[model samples]
Target: MTPITRSTAQLYETDFVAWTEKTVQLIRAGQFEKNDKSELLLSGKSGNKRF
Candidate 1:
């Protein structure tokens, strides 16, 4: 892989991990906001209780 592409992928992975951790913390603390909760309710998943 190209150096630039590899670096970008690493950065994206790190950001994604950090975001997931923060989201979990918010959920555990009952601090999740309505707008953010809407985003987490993945369309069809919510309909089927897949979450």
Candidate 2:
């Protein structure tokens, strides 16, 4: 996992492609701590789910 820098929730709708690319890059880099787990999780799902 790689973490991306904090971004507003609106950014996902405003530029989904860029956001996805940035997210992929961050994950590939192994910067897990920077990723926003809450934002990534589906509503009603537990954050404890792990790979």
Backbone collision count in every prediction? 0, 4
Runs in model 2 with CA error above 4 Å? 1-14, 41-51
Q: Which pairs, if any, clash in model 2?
A: 2-27, 2-31, 3-31, 3-35
Q: Provide the lDDT at 21 for model 2.
A: 76
Writing each residue's lDDT as its tens digit, candidate 2 over 1-51 gives: 665545755666669777677877888999867766655644346644533
Using alpha carbons, what is the TM-score of model 2?
0.45
Q: Provide the global lDDT of candidate 2 against the true structure.
A: 0.66
What TM-score would candidate 1 get against the native? 0.62
lDDT at 39, model 1: 42
Angstrom error at residue 47, model 1: 3.8
Worst 10 residues of 1 by lDDT: 34-43
Off by over 4 Å in 1: 1-4, 42-51
Q: What is the lDDT of residue 9 in candidate 1?
A: 92
Per-model TM-score on C-alpha atoms: 0.62, 0.45
